[model samples]
Target chain A: MNQTAMAENKAITISFPEELSEVQEMVRACIQCGTCSGSCPNEFAMDFTPRRLWRMVLMGQKDDIFKSKTFSLCSSCYYCTLRCPRGLPLTEAMAALKQIAAKDGLSKYKQSSLFYKSFLESVRRHGKVREMEFMTMYFTAMKSPFLPFRFAALGMRLMGKGKVHIQIPSKGEGKLKAIFRKVEEMEGR
Target chain B: MNYLYYPGCSLEGSALEYNLSTIAFMEAMGIELTEIEDWTCCGASAAESVSHLLSLALPARNLALAETMELDADLMIPCSACYLNLRNVAEKIKKEPDILNEINTVLKEDNLELKGDIQVRHLLDVVATDLGADSLAPKIRKSLDGLSIAPYYGCQCLRPYTVFDDPEKPTTMEPLINVTGARVHAWDMGGKCCGASHMNTKMDVGMELVAAILRAARGADAVVTVCPMCQMNLEAYQKKISATYGEDLSMTILYLPQLIGLAIGLSDKDLRLDLNLSITESFRNKLNNDCVK
Candidate 1:
């Protein structure tokens, strides 16, 4: 790998290319009026805040911004985008930044993302999100050995509470395979 | 009107009842849903969050399949996650031609292309627009009297674009609720995030988020949502929250279609009341049996 690529991989933070004129335009759209920061419920918890994230994107400090925990804390409620005086897509920008951060394998908040992956993949393969029985097994296997009892505890509790339904496969298995093929192709899997 | 339908992962699985009811409800409304020949996952919130290319490629592949079908009709996505992913891919492709080309190259093997011809509209948009409120109101044989519903738009369908309505405070489902004679509960968190995928990642954070939404939705009969992720999070995690917080607020969550189906005179059996986590028996009792039957 070349110096720049190697440097980028280890940079801990990342930014998109300058040719991504969309990011530039979006950054320009943000007047840094702090409406987003003001409206953001989690802004106080975030290190760099939304306004600073926008600024970093504009300044091409991609690596530094992507590494921050602020991007992960963006709940994507879109209060920022809706409240922004410039009508900038601040929430959308945060969502994009979160994706970029995940690309570099640096999601500080990954449990939900991991569940989303396993559950989604299961649905793609099974042609349905089966209720408790399959979901528990899948999640347990995925989060195995680390917190094995947590999975069992979750399952037993859900069952006791009657939250976990015994969902049947409403469709045939062939349909699932076809759906899986298409989804896997999309994921380049 | 005909549509190239993309069911996505949820309809086929966890939200199967939603899928069944949507198909039934749409057919009842005279909308033709031509299931795309071989559609795939839209990566939903996970793949895209983890891998951007996978997210775009997943939806792009479906879009390409719809294009190859040569269907000039709009592609109606019932699932909110699928709708968002498909719309995002279309929007991204317009900006990143190279990514589009690269995706098309992958589709070459499968004989598809992610052309942006197909208009991706949510099931709610079709029900509200295609079958006008007047049309829907008359069709509502079972008026949902005394039933108070909190219209939850969730985060996916409304935001990112002004395609349908205002994201921060959306009321797309309110008119439908009004038409059914079910009172729409005035709540501040209609378009708010319910801690969504966070429920799985950080259980406490997720439960707290759901708790906030539920607490805000106090005094409502039930919470109606469009997205499966939202429904799953709100419905499945409520018990955990109630246990953790020592509060009891069990709200019945239903897909917009399921609620509409009930109002338009479909039975609870047809709407799959069994799948829900809340007091569906009470909800079922609320539906006017004479009109629905």
Candidate 2:
């Protein structure tokens, strides 16, 4: 191909923004040995295996990477990171991908992202996670009436065992307010 | 030896049995644990998915609180996820001074500062390493002999950071189990993933992994784990997993310290065994016959 043609082809391919520099740098050392995919416990559930995801990451296929639920399905087992001969931080990279998706407000990751948000919000309020409150907030935010029913049996069992405590929601001790505020200010969120 | 304890959010809630058993077992062993006052959450795995800085800052705040105590001792955590979160920040701050400085800036808001000098140790490390089999053997008031127990290490305790045990194949818990006079059930699922929060986010995937672990645990009288997430997953999902897989996958799941507490002559109430989801009658009978004075 001619120089102009090569430049045109490169421009047509989707490229990652500067935000993904750390992830890109980490994945650059991938030898494509498929050790990550082989080691991943949830690989069968992922739309794209970890190996293919790393390849897309290396090629800067940002759109394709975002469309797949590969990173969201990661259970953070760290098996791949441990087995990878290249010693890449695969688990951290997966977390980084989730962080970017959450920051960008991708629609596909709405449920999982909302779950994390509700969890942190509980922490922010009480300095500890009140499971009943957190799950209530999550179910409400999800707007799925049927979602609570799905977990109702387990919830009842836990409550029966005195595992779930019911307390009136009050303003928490606010122990983490300063830390959360400081982090928010630092991250400029 | 005395140590600063950070019982993350779960200990006060769903994993209260773990907290109860840990304190009882440690007291019996004569180890001192001073709870860190006014400590906040460690952000678990949730904070990282939301904000990396918040994840570091949340845990750093606790470390700063520990530092203020001037305990000159390690900060011990019982929850695997909390251990990973705190240890991750501690290791990062040690390797990169700038990250420590950045986290310190956030801690400044709470009138705290992290020196990044305190060591973070898991309860398993303290038990298996600090109190080895030699020290544990004589304390076995009730022998767990003939009870085939599977030692399940789960993932977080061993992985991403292989400080005290092998990430892939862990034998630390085995020796501890043997010291209780129990035969360690030979199994490869000890260090496997329990699907972590995926059980909440993606139920099918988490159930699949849990089913695999439970199936591999067959022939063992019970599965003993150090991490609360693993305990909850292995015990809570048996009915659903069995229904999904069309097999009897029920297995008794106990916290590591709970099992140790039993062998060390602690009562069932002390270990909170009733709080556990599944405890086989045979296993209970064995404990009653051998351990109960």
Q: After superposition, which runs of candidate 1 have C-alpha atoms over 4 Å from their true positions?
A: A1-30, A41-48, A55-67, A86-89, A107-189, B94-99, B288-293
Per-model C-alpha lDDT, please?
0.71, 0.88
| Docking model 1 quality class | acceptable
Each prediction's fraction of true contacts recovered = 0.32, 0.91
Give all TM-scores, in the order shown: 0.80, 0.95
**How many clashing residue pairs appear in each of the predictions shown?**
10, 0
Q: CAPRI band of model 2? A: medium
lDDT of 2 at A158: 79
Tens digits of per-residue lDDT for model 2, B95-119: 8999999999998888888998899
DockQ of each: 0.27, 0.71
Lowest summed lDDT across 10 adjacent residues in model 2 chain A is found at A7-16
Give the Å error, residue A119, model 1.
5.8
TM-score of chain B of each: 0.94, 0.98
Top DockQ hit: 2
> Worst ten-residue run, lDDT, model 2 chain B?
B284-293
